[model samples]
Target: MKREEFEKIVEETIESLPEEIKQKLDNVVFIVQDYPDSDELKKTKASKYNLLGLYTGIPLSKRGTSYGMYPATPDRIFIFKANIERICRNEKELKTKIREVVLHEIGHYLGMSEEEVRKALGE
Candidate 1:
């Protein structure tokens, strides 16, 4: 799929999120990259070809009173376009996979661990 179409799906998926979830997503940025970089692969310990998304920076739940006293980078959620496309064979599958990857990363941004996020997703 084209990057434009893929990005549009991502935007639509985010827009479809619950109002409460959307409201709490302050100081966060969504990025689309074709693949994971070497550093990201090492940090997440994930292989390059299969990793669908990643969340970086401090999670909201881990913040304390002093959190915003200094300038801070916004949390990042990276959606891996090529990797997602690799696993999905059709547009419907692509859309479903994108939503899953997005929601999974968002769970991490919200301070849920991998296990916690999986459980919440009934995985």
Candidate 2:
């Protein structure tokens, strides 16, 4: 798929989220990249070929009272476009995979552990 189409799908996926989830996404930015960067791969310890998405920054649950006292960078959720496309054979599968990866990363943003996120997604 074209980069523009892929990004549109990502935006739609997030918009399709339940209102409860959408409301909690304050101070979060969604980014789409062709591949994971070296630093991101090292930080997550994930192979570039397999890492579909990643969430970075302090999770909401971990924030203390002083959390916003100073200017803070927004949390980021990265969607690795090329990696996602590589594992899918068609657009339908591509869309599904995008949703799954997005939700998984959002789970992390909401303070769920990897295991918790997996269990929640029935993976």
lDDT (0 to 1) per candidate: 0.93, 0.93
* Candidate 1 root-mean-square deviation in Å: 0.9
- Can you list the residue pairs that collide in candidate 1? none
Would you give me the overall lDDT of model 2?
A: 0.93
Global fold similarity of model 2 (TM-score):
0.96
Q: In model 1, where is the ten-residue run with the lowest total lDDT?
A: 39-48
Q: What is the alpha-carbon lDDT of model 1 when measured against the actual structure?
A: 0.93
lDDT of 1 at 42: 79
**Model 1, span 14-121: residue lDDT tens:** 999999999989789999999999978877878998799999989989988898899999989999999999999999999999999999999999999999999998
lDDT of 2 by residue, 76-107 (tens): 99999999999999999999999999999999
TM-scores of all models? 0.96, 0.96
Off by over 4 Å in 2: none
